[model samples]
Target: MGVSPDTAQGLLDELFLISRALRRNLAQPEEGRLLPGGISVLVNLESAGPCRQVDLAAQIGISASAMSRHITELVADGYVLRNTDPDDGRAIRVEVSSTGHELLGRIRESRIQGLQEVMADWTQDDAERARHILHTLRSQLIARDSRNAAADHQKHSEERIDVQ
Candidate 1:
């Protein structure tokens, strides 16, 4: 069964608020801390291993130029290493450096500590339940977005064929 309109609206509102709050929190600068975008790039690279710049941009939903800038800064900061793509001599692949991994560990620890403080009133079970529900919701949303993007691409391809 579909969710009620009111429930859907509530969920959207909550998500929006959560996103805003997180953005605001991340905006507060800590000494030697990476910006949110840079952190996201590092995290993605760390999890996905080495990837081409364009592929990383697409995966992170950012422009290639923006990804290049992030990579440049990261490389300068010694947080990532850029190497020639073995399979494609002309292309470059980026991977998290040892320093990057160390930074990520620190970042994770800080975030966990912050979350622990925020959730201090909640029981362990409450945190686990919330995590499970949020993870499922995130997976469903990604799958739905992938399906929609595929359908749109197919429609555009058919339209181009009809025109030709």
Candidate 2:
């Protein structure tokens, strides 16, 4: 059965509220320490190990130039280290520094504490279910977005050919 209009509206409203709450209430890594999107870069590098700038950009779905800007700021902040790829001297690989790892650990602890405080009233099962549902929703959204982007690109390419 399809969701009713009212149910859909409610879902949208709740999702917006959740987004705002997380953005505003979640403990920030540090005040004026890292540029916007820097945390994502650091975390990804830590998880994925040293990676070329282009690869990191593609993985994060950002332009290489934009990613480079973030990397520059991160490097200046001593959170990331950049070095020439030994296998490909033309490419630069980025890795998280020791300081970056410590910062990430602190951020993780803060977020965990914040989440625990927020979910204090929830049962263990409720917390587990919430995590599962959120992950499933995120995966579905990403897949749908990727499919839409591909279709749009194909449509644009066809339109260009048609015009020619």
Candidate 3:
């Protein structure tokens, strides 16, 4: 007897539109070309301290080969530096370049501007309440996903057998 499913879907649709516009606005000011995935790798490297490529892939939710390709581009762009892992002779690690850190700062400011505009009409209290709700929603979603991922993966694997 609460909100209808159709109304919920309409809300989701509006959220997507807002998110897309925000992303576009965030990407517009950056002079350098770093795709979202590539910038993500930079951020991970900056925070995670030069982890092995395999571990970075898992942390970033991308395949190892795809991480390699992304690293290739990031290195070529001078936003990342890769080296042999001193502790592990067989493994490689990557770190964000000084340039990458500088760029990340700039991009972060640019990204926040769009979000600020979206909330321009809201009072400080209203913004705080919205942030709390979003954080709560995200945490709940992550918990739910962790519980369901194994079942979903197994179901996909079973479905893949029929396709093959």
Per-candidate local distance difference test: 0.86, 0.86, 0.81
**Candidate 2 ranges with C-alpha deviation above 4 Å:** 4-6, 29-31, 149-164
TM-score per model over all chains: 0.87, 0.82, 0.77
Worst 10 residues of 2 by lDDT: 27-36
Clashing pairs in 3: none
Candidate with maximal lDDT: 2
Candidate 2 lDDT over residue span 1-164, tens digit each: 78899997998899999877975787484824666777878888788899998898887888989898999999898889999998989878999999889888988888789989998999999989988988997898899989998999999999999999
Residue-level lDDT of model 3, residues 1-164, one tens digit each, is: 87799997997898799777766666745544665577778878888987788888887779989988988988888888888889988777888888878888888887788678877899999999988987996798778877788789999999999999
Please provide the root mean square deviation of candidate 2 (C-alpha atoms, Å). Answer: 2.6
Poorly placed runs, candidate 1 (over 4 Å): 23-36
State the lDDT at 120 in candidate 1: 87
As for model 3, its CA RMSD to the true structure in angstroms is 4.2
| Residue 81 lDDT (model 2) | 94
lDDT of 1 by residue, 3-118 (tens): 99999999999999988776665333431365448988998999889999899898888999999998998998899999999998998999999998988887777767777877
Q: Give the candidate number with the greatest TM-score.
A: 1
